[model samples]
Target: MKLLMMAACAGLTLNTAAAQEMSYGHAEYLNSCAVCHGVDGTGDGPLRDLLIRRPADLTQLSERNGGTFPYSRVFATIDGRYAVPSHGNREMPVWGRLFLEDDAKNYGPSGGEVVTTERIHNLAGYIETLQH
Candidate 1:
């Protein structure tokens, strides 16, 4: 029936959209955060031993913050608006300007800041899923 076909098509559309969103976040995580945060979002990245201090176990963020994910803090930290002490000088890079430059290259300067915001927001949303 048309109704059944429509429902199935709608479900596929939603699923495809979800898959794309998850792909963006997962790709971003693997590209940027995994170098320091590890593939599983723990603090056990390959470069962990090279740093001055061990990175925070990302899975514990919600537990440490009393069972709620610190979404804003995570966003700010990703975008360089907030400082996380454990990141240290050698461990963390200020991604805001770098992300802006990236956006400027891809979409021009007019929307660089907005693009950076979206990237950071997506990255934060991805991190939230890592909660224990």
Candidate 2:
């Protein structure tokens, strides 16, 4: 997790928008999930109107799961191992597979898997913090 946070910070540049105002996970969320889940995880991003089904209200994840954040499920969801209908076929997660491929190049096989898992864990932790 620390390694991933360092990597996230290393990728940031002085020209980035409101960099200091955002935490690493928040920045990650904005770069990825926020496009479909919204800044507050309310399922009302710009693409909401264009999709066949509404994105889940991420903030309600805990509420919907007996007041406990479904950590492993969320981790699996982000990792693309879980079958999310909106994300399309499990065999090919167009979005996440791209990241996996890129990570494989940047970090190699074992390292990339480690990095990817850490990223998923970090992102899941961030989502847990957002539960209301």
Candidate 3:
């Protein structure tokens, strides 16, 4: 009985870890970015109607960049390190800040920067998968 309980707990831990890792970037994109970029990364999100400048069609990032995904640029853009002219004073939420806040809640305040960077990388990598 004890062995069975231990096995069950181990299974639960593995499942939870896998789910968290798999959903990390996708969840961030959906919660923060899909409002502008759309679930399909087509930039036709519901908020598009409210914006003066249309949200960029994220699927075309590679095409717009000579058929190569600009990974660093995308990461910087998300982290607010690279300013996007159309975004206007970075009105869109700075995800780095939000991630740091979230990390502080989960992992405490000391290593928030590392958490923020990992979040940016996860988000940027997810966007790369959206490229056409």
Candidate 4:
């Protein structure tokens, strides 16, 4: 009946939304992070050796972080919040602010915290899938 049709349509809509969100994250990684991190998240890109502290081997993150990847901490570090002191300075750009600016430019008005949160979540999700 009409109720069933409506539910089906709603589900389809949600699925489409989710797909779009995932695509954005994938695109973002491909466009920005992949240059340094490598497409396979191995940190073996051409610029890897140029970095003073060396890019992280993301696939081994869990082993490096006590058998559990501290995702929140990783997200914070990627977003340039929790600085690695031994890295010798903030070498990575603050992605949170960069994403906010990009969102503002794309949406006319800034999406503010929501967009930042989504970007972080999406990036984190992408990173989680990199674990070996």
Candidate 5:
């Protein structure tokens, strides 16, 4: 029936959209975080030794931090909110604003904080998947 066919098409379309969004998050992680965190999340990247404080091995984050990944803490760090005085400056760029700026350029005037939050949530979701 046409109704059945339409329902199937809608389901497929939603699945495809989700897949694409996840792919974007994964790609963003590879391009942005892998240089410091390593593709395996082991903190063994080439640039790790050059830094004063070594990059945290992301795979062990939950174990190291009392058996919880502390999603908000991780998010804050990525957004450059947690101050690391020992490092002399922020080790990571603030991605919240960066994502917002990028979205604004692409989505006309309506792109704002909500888009940034969605981007952060997507990236966070991708990071959560990295946990073993």
Candidate 6:
């Protein structure tokens, strides 16, 4: 029936959107966070032994935060707007600014902020999906 076909199409569209969104975040993570957090978000990255402080296991974030995903907190951390001691005296690059820089380079500066926000949110959403 038309109704069944419509529902199936809608589901496919949603799934495709979700897959694209997650793919963006996953790619960003691999490029940036995975060096310290590991590709699996296990805090056992190859560079872990070189860092002064151990990276937190991203998979345990929900467990540490009382069973709810700390969406805002993760966003802030990735955005690097506020100082976080855990990020080590701000030595690490702020991912938000980095994304903005890329956007500005590719699309000019008109809507860099929007792209930056999307990048951070997508990354945070992907991290949320990684929660155990």
Candidate 1 or 6, higher lDDT? 6
lDDT of model number 1 = 0.83
Best by lDDT: 6
Query: Which stretches of model 5 miss by more than 4 angstroms?
Result: 1-22, 81-88, 108-110
Give the TM-score (vs. native) of candidate 3: 0.74
lDDT accuracy of residue 130 in candidate 1? 89
Tell me how candidate 3 scores on lDDT: 0.85
Write candidate 5's Cα lDDT for 1-132 as tens digits.
999999999999999888787666677777778888888778877788877878877777678788888788777777664466786786667887677787788875476666776667666667777777
Writing each residue's lDDT as its tens digit, candidate 3 over 41-130 gives 998989988987788888999999999999998988899854657766755667777778889888888787788898889889999999
lDDT of 6: 0.86
Candidate 2 Cα outliers beyond 4 Å, as residue runs: 1-18, 82-96
Question: Clashing pairs in model 6?
Answer: none
How well does candidate 4 match the true structure in TM-score terms?
A: 0.70
> In candidate 4, which residue pairs get closer than 3 Å at backbone N, Cα or C atoms, i.e. clash?
none
Name the lDDT value of residue 54 in candidate 3.
82
> What TM-score would every model get versus the actual structure?
0.75, 0.75, 0.74, 0.70, 0.68, 0.75
lDDT of 1 at 108: 85
Deviating ranges (above 4 Å) for candidate 3:
1-23, 81-88
Worst 10 residues of 6 by lDDT: 83-92
- Candidate 1 residue-wise lDDT, 8-76, digit = tens: 999999998887867667778888888878998998888888888887788999999999999988887
Error of 2 at 113 (Å): 0.7
Error of 6 at 116 (Å): 1.2
Per-residue lDDT tens digits for candidate 2, residues 1-132, read 999988788677543656786776787788888877898999988877777778789999999999999998887777775465786554213445656777889999888777777766778888898988
